[model samples]
Target chain A: AQSVTQLDSQVPVFEEAPVELRCNYSSSVSVYLFWYVQYPNQGLQLLLKYLSGSTLVKGINGFEAEFNKSQTSFHLRKPSVHISDTAEYFCAVIPVYNTDKLIFGTGTRLQVFP
Target chain B: DTAVSQTPKYLVTQMGNDKSIKCEQNLGHDTMYWYKQDSKKFLKIMFSYNNKELIINETVPNRFSPKSPDKAHLNLHINSLELGDSAVYFCASSQVVTGDNYGYTFGSGTRLTVV
Candidate 1:
């Protein structure tokens, strides 16, 4: 089985400031990493993913994440956050083989203030 | 057009009542999934279907049943709803591709509140 842990429960940052959301995963085998964002009363939307290529993966809304194999971490980062970026973020992982079901973290709320 | 759509975005019902949440995906994906998000904002996969075949069924209670009539539709039917079952249920679908990567497209989610 695969599991994910989001270190931070909430991260507050001023608008235009950089932000980082930490995520860690534990799996018996190799896995795929993903980040998702959800606004209030909305379902999760895919942000970025790290599969096999470069360690640095970029996604929509100017968000990016780095996959670190040794540390079993995939942290999401944004150079400058906008007020609209405030949302709940989730880090997920799926085993290399087996089913495509994703194991999500507890989620971290990113609050971008003006 | 919405990639993944769910009907009755909000469902409020009483205990012991049965309700069904409908989900549809038009992305031509071969896999569909049902997930539950608790009040604490923890997302967990409940069931997954591929090509209308049940593939992954989590340790969800028997009262929670998932039915996939076709490749594009997956519905969740809950019997004897309980207070703990009240949460946001999301429907997602993904296409099986290489790179060990598959992007999931999620529905707007149905918020179920059992009184």
Candidate 2:
């Protein structure tokens, strides 16, 4: 079984300011991680995913996330945020070598202010 | 061209009513899924179909049913809906041949409101 937890329910930040949205997961075996963003009343869009290899993964719209095996976390980070970046972000996981559907976290709402 | 599309973008219905939402994908993928996002913004997988076969069915209520007439089309129907059934339903498609069949293209979503 696998599960994901997004630490922050809501994050308020100023424009051009750096921000981080924390995510952690619990799994009994190896897993694949993903970060998805959803605009208002829209479907979820994949930002990035970590299947293997490097711990650091970059995504579209200037977003990035680092996979920490020790901490069991894949926190999303952006050097600078824009008002357009305001959206709901979700962290999800799928067990490796297992035919399971993606399990998503509660989601974190990023509110970028001017 | 849209990769994934669902009908009834916004549906308003009363309790005990029955409704159906249709989904179609042009991605030529073998697998499709249905997900529900509650008002709390928590997404949960409800059903998945591969090659028009039922693959995964979660702990959804019996009132909810999924039908896949073909690999490219999946439809969801609700019978005797309740107020708690209100949610945003998303239709997604992905390829199954690859290891990471998790690469899903999602539909805009059908916001169903039951009063």
DockQ of each: 0.72, 0.69
Give me the overall lDDT of model 2.
0.93
Could you estimate the TM-score for every candidate?
0.97, 0.96
Which prediction has the highest DockQ against the true structure? 1
> Where in model 2 is the C-alpha error above 4 Å?
B97-102
TM-score of chain B of 1: 0.96
Residue-wise C-alpha lDDT for candidate 1, range B16-53, written one tens digit per residue: 99999999999999999999998999898999999999
Candidate 1 iRMSD, 1 decimal: 1.8
Q: For candidate 2, write residues B47-67 as lDDT tens digits.
A: 999999988999999899999
For all predictions in the order shown, the interface RMSD in Å is 1.8, 1.9
**After superposition, candidate 1 runs with Cα above 4 Å error:** B99-101
User: How would you encode candidate 1's per-residue C-alpha lDDT over A1-114 as one tens digit per residue?
Assistant: 789999899999999999999999999899888999999888888999988889999999999999999999999999999999999999998876764788899999999999
lDDT of each: 0.93, 0.93
